[model samples]
Target: MKRRALLSSLAAGSVAALAGCNERGNATTGTTTHDDSTRTTTPTTSDAPTPPDTGLADATTAVFETRDRTISLLGGRRRLPSGLVMRAWLSATATADHPARVTATLTNDTEYETTLRLDEVPPFDTTPHASPGRDYDHTLYLAPTERHGFATTVPAVARAESGGWYLDGPPDRWQPEAVELAPGETLVGEFAVVPERPDSFPPGRYAFGYTDDPLTLSAWQSSQPGPTEESAFEDATPPAFAEQSPAWYHDATPETQAFLRPSAERVDAPAAVEFTLHNHRTEPLSGNVYDWTLYKQVEDDWYHIAPWAIPVPLTPLAPGDTHTWTFHAFSGPSVECENAVALGHLGGGRYAFHVNMSSESGPTHAALFDIDAPAVSVTPTEDVSVEREYRLVRASTPDDGGDRATLVVQRTDDADTRLLPEQVMRPRNRGLRNTLPFFEDGVQKVRLRTTDGVVDDALHGGEPERVFRYDGNAFAAWRA
Candidate 1:
């Protein structure tokens, strides 16, 4: 009976903590211990039971920060016993207009590289809020004390069978990259302290501190490993050009054929383009129809502009089925800045629409559209001449062991066309069956309208199982 009772209490503790409740009492004097980062703060606590001592090394604290504009925590530095020096400060614009941000820096005094994952380190959490993944979850309320309490929640090291103990919330935008700092190298990351809601915190005193454990720190004992391996496409296929003006942009694999053409609307007006994918094979063809973007050509260069379709929460097309994505085409600097030149505000230009469609056979084929549209305004003196030939160059990387293929524009030399930074797909084993790219597939199917059951169940208190195969990059829906 005692064993059963203990198990019950353990389960209850996990549930209450997952619900965003700080199990420790509100800090009255202004110090609390954080198990997430394994550090202790001297904050005063109320008469509630104290949490277990984490036995972390001794650390000192200065005022991490407060609302007073007069003082600054920017240069304040502290050295941990582990030889990691930490520094934190507020941004210049932590005022009412902008959200509060805290920048934390760590310097490794030792000789090796350290792998620190930002997501695993629990930030100082505010309470009296909704669940973490919801829209209103950003509304963090203070504990009416000098120091905020530490959350026991840690990033789930592995996928949870249920949604009860998942670490990722929308606000935890910590880059999942392992921070590997070489000997004497410094690593810096920023965490947001204020909630998006203007009313989350009023003018007040709040002290924030972090835990001792740096997430996934890999100390360099010997010579550190080198940079990640990258390979270029070898044995690339030749450029496939579509028919002349009488036809639209067309390309095909044994299973599917894609056609891209401008809508009947005049080029001078608000423009739209039509993209269709047809399955030519007899068996049911299931390919992730999402993962698409658009780029436009101005003069001699191509720049990324817009998404061809609304990103997916939708379904893929069935065999003998078709999908279409239509949108007002745009063109601008590949990297948008406030002062960047405004090139094609009125629309009408050459565009390249690319989509990645993968199936059980691996990432098979992608669509590349090269189409010319009239300028935003057809001025009498403006010459609408297209000098360059627009073609889609489908290249199969022979070096990648046929695991991946890419679509690029066809340049004059039939060499691989230059692609914007956002255009490159980092090589990875994209063969995972459950991983479906869910960007706009152009076709708005009914199945895509459903919510992810895992997230839905987590927020709504329902049973969450493998209703859909979970993938970090794409959304996979439940199979009927």
Candidate 2:
């Protein structure tokens, strides 16, 4: 369903599609002009029935945006230092017509991992990146205070990914990390710029950026901003263990099952993936590297990923207490896939996730069902006559609540009633409906039952019923 166009004409504007820009230097000055008469026109004349004003290509929006900014570096420095890349854009915006997109891309022009510094001259809050939300699988953090820190939060980016978490706190907060970046490889993210409008702010123009309209950076970048910056991050060094090689644990220590298996829907893997492992034993497990051998169930070949191998120093495990750790792996060529991850780890220990598939000699690692119970609900009736809206209600009684419960739906119909089916709901979701038609309504009896899976404290489910009244008239009229 879309609006149709009546006339055909080219919109006026430079038809030149903007090619992406590179790190500009003093070496290049004027706009490089292409040959004349060769410029192209968009929405060119077509014979196969013209397209509507809106198409998938034309529909876009801004999810992230910022106001504009401009700054004066200490010595009038226009270009950032080597191993650095910077992009300044104006305004935060959204809602199609006010579209904004972050196009800051990493330039692998450096030999090793590097950091893109973020510093504001004065008075305004500084943002070092234009696109940090492009990748949807992970979480993004902002530095609170210091402006200049190199490296990406992701470690493998080698100087590009800064992942260490730091709180600069209100007015000036930030986070930084280090990654091993390689040449010619680029990591990209995106954002949008937008303005703020609240019931309290009147019709006056509210500036979106610091000092200048769009964004600008100048001060201190020139002679290198004075060294007032000191990362809240204390030690820049990694733990001694992370520097050592990895060892594969392949012995039987009798891992006892604490609970039933997790639900199939909650289970992440059949084999290569185990939710998380706890240190049930008394001794501490220490290792510099962790190597995991994953396999594709269908392919029968080994898959590889850098599993998190960490160290637990001479710390003793108090009987009845435990420590937990998780491992994640992604896809590969013939049988490969990658997934996004969430969850943060406190640093001080060496943490790395590398993917390397190789042959191994050992007994297979297996999983036992520590299953979780299923959740459900039962309802009596979903529909009622317009006359009964005040009396009839959808009702359900869970197994546990049955003894402690009373009438869920008030007395209404006397002729016939159809009970509703139960459904499973995940975290944060609600109001899901079932489309099964009511079975010949009048008044019918429905009941609920359960088992250990239904009674577990960790599981959720219920059973409910309804009475159908021919004249009680207490339900909402079906909106045909």
* Global lDDT of each candidate: 0.30, 0.22
lDDT of 2 by residue, 310-380 (tens): 34333321211222223322111112224423221111111222222111231222222211222223212
User: Which numbered prediction scores highest in TM-score against the true structure?
Assistant: 1
The residue ranges of model 2 lying beyond 4 angstroms of the native Cα positions read 1-79, 88-93, 96-99, 115-180, 195-214, 217-480
Candidate 2 accuracy as TM-score: 0.18
| Global Cα RMSD, each model | 24.7, 25.9
Query: What is the RMSD of candidate 1?
Result: 24.7
Candidate 1, residue 89: the lDDT equals 36
TM-score of candidate 1 to 2 decimals: 0.22
- Model 2: weakest 10-residue lDDT segment is 3-12
lDDT of 1: 0.30
Runs off by more than 4 Å, candidate 1: 1-248, 252-266, 284-290, 298-302, 308-314, 330-348, 362-480
Candidate 2: lDDT over CA atoms?
Answer: 0.22
- In Å, residue 118's CA in model 2 sits off its true spot by 3.7
